[model samples]
Target: MATILMITGDFVEDYENMVPFQALMAMGHQVDAVCPGKSAGENIATAIHDFEGDQTYTEKRGHNFTLNANFDSVEAEDYDALYIPGGRSPEYLRLNTQVIGLIQNFFAAGKPIASICHGVQLLTAAGVIEGKKVSAYPACQPEVEAAGAEFVHIEMDQAITDSNLVTAPAWPAHPAMLSQFVKLFK
Candidate 1:
């Protein structure tokens, strides 16, 4: 089983954070969920982003998710893979230099990384997605392109894997995204 590091923060999408964390654990992988400036046992508020008949997704308050690891204690080399969930959180997480460095470490190590929706923002900000094909929320396409990655416009329920990276547009693509991600472990 692999030890996966999940980097998340307040306002992270509920399903994106909860489902993958639980699903990976159910598969016998050790998943450590962490947030900047927080420690194990601490909790981060989540939000539900739903697509309605609107121009974009709608947000609603979601459950509080507990952290299982301390961000400061995380050593990127200790984990076999990285999981980054999407939501409004990525918008600011990208600004954290340590967070960007952590992501770069994983990329430099050639480890597998899975990102969804806005999570691509972190990868872009880390300057590690250049020359890759990445999928993220439609609103993130421009950033992906500007970061030198080819933006993949796919179905909401689909995912794409480029080298050691697996990405999807949103949580709806969990099945495809996770399946592809797990393959990297093999």
Candidate 2:
């Protein structure tokens, strides 16, 4: 069983955060969810990003997700893999130095990393996606490309894995994304 660290923040996507956490747990993996500056038992607001035929996905208030671990207490080397969910969180999380360093540590140590939707923003900010092939929410195509990664286009249910990085466009690709990610443990 892999020890997975799931990083999230306020306004993280509801499904993106919960689905994988529960799914992996059901599969016998230990998934520890943490938010920067938050401790165990603290909750963060989740957002629902639904495609209501608007120009983009619509957002609404979602459930409160509780953190089961303390961010300050975790070290990247202690985990076997990393999971980053998408939502508005990445917009600001990308600017967090500690978050960026943690991400860099994972990349440096070659641990598997799974990122969805806007979560790719952090990978861009961390400078780890350079020269890698990845897939991200369509809106982040330019940013991924700008960061020196080749953005892959695929069906919503598909995912792309490049070495230790597993990426999906959005929550719709969770099944494939997590499946590909779990394979890294072998």
Candidate 3:
């Protein structure tokens, strides 16, 4: 089983984050939700995770993970790949120098990196998506491209793959996204 280090912030897309986390477990892969901060009993607090204005809010707590580890803590050569989920979390996560360093560590080693929704922001901020084809929430197209990536747009299509990277749209595309990501480890 592949040891997948999935990171998040204070608030992230709850469902999108959980689905893959659960799927990886079901597939017998080791998954850890690394976060920037924590709440009760060393667990991270994740709310509605809304960044666009604000619709509704709810707070759910997940166990504390590796917030201190950077690219130097774990090399890309150690892990098989990385999966990034969308949410306002990306905006905050991209700001973490440690996280950005880890992102680059993976790409430089040619390890597969899967990014969904606003998660693309992390890759963009890390300067690892350049010259690659990617897709996001549409509004983020400019940012992704500006980071040196080609944005793929389509209502229904296969996941976009560029070298060791994989990109997909929103939640509706999770099935395809998860399946494609699983194959990367095998």
In order, the Cα lDDT scores of the candidates are 0.97, 0.95, 0.73
Best by TM-score: 1
TM-scores of the candidates in the order shown? 0.99, 0.98, 0.81
Q: Tell me the number of clashing residue pairs for each predicted model.
A: 0, 0, 2
**Between prediction 1 and prediction 2, which has the larger lDDT?**
1
Write model 2 residue lDDT over 1-186, tens digit each, in one string: 999999899999999999999999999999999989899999999999998889999999999998999999999989999999999999999989999999999999999999999999999999999999999889999999999999999887889999999999889998899889999985
Query: 1 or 3, which is superior by lDDT?
Result: 1
Candidate 2, superposed: residue stretches over 4 Å from native: none
**lDDT digits (tens) for residues 60-134 of candidate 3:** 544323233333345456678898987678998899888898889888887777888789999999998888988
> lDDT tens digits, residues 50-151, model 1?
999899999999999999999999999899999999999999999999999999999999999999999999999999999999999999999999999999
| Model number with the top lDDT | 1
Worst 10 residues of 2 by lDDT: 151-160
Kindly give the stretch of ten consecutive residues in candidate 3 with the minimal lDDT sum: 63-72
Worst 10 residues of 1 by lDDT: 177-186
In model 1, the runs with Cα more than 4 Å from the true position are none
